[model samples]
Target: MASAIPLTRADMKRLADYAKREGVKAEVQIDDFIFRVSADHPPAKVDGSEESELDRELMEFDRKHGYR
Candidate 1:
């Protein structure tokens, strides 16, 4: 049972506007004086077309160290 904080109309509108600009879903929750805001966004995709030099070196090191 957490404490909840009361937010004014202006505060709510500001938060909503921020969420809209970020292109993410916003969630707000209040519990016993606590106000929480969270954003949900998809994970970024990685390019795997070619192995970088550092990647190749790390792989070689892992093979030598017997790190599966």
Candidate 2:
């Protein structure tokens, strides 16, 4: 098994600052006693087809489940 690695407060602060500058959101998770950080943002909506496909799928699912 791998060992846990510890980070200083300065390191965490730097990461958060960088994320804010880049317009990214940060997520932190804990596994057992370990902590991890992740940054994410909404993916670029490529084109109309991609968005239309998503909407179509949602509409179909809703119709199937009687959510509409």
RMSD of each: 6.3, 9.5
Q: lDDT by residue for model 1 over 1-68, one digit each (tens)? A: 64345788788777867876786556665554443444556698766644476798889999999995
The candidate that achieves the highest lDDT relative to the unseen native structure? 2
Q: Could you give me the TM-score of model 1 versus the true structure? A: 0.37
Error of 2 at 12 (Å): 27
- The sequence of per-residue lDDT tens digits that candidate 2 reaches over residues 1-68 is 87554656887788777776777755555455443445566687789998899999999999999999
Clashes of 2: 0
Model 2 TM-score is: 0.34
**Candidate 1, superposed: residue stretches over 4 Å from native:** 1-5, 8-10, 16-20, 23-32, 50-68
Q: Provide the clash count, candidate 1.
A: 11
What C-alpha lDDT do the candidate models reach, one value each? 0.68, 0.71
How big is the positional error of residue 30 in model 2, measured in Å on the Cα after superposition? 36
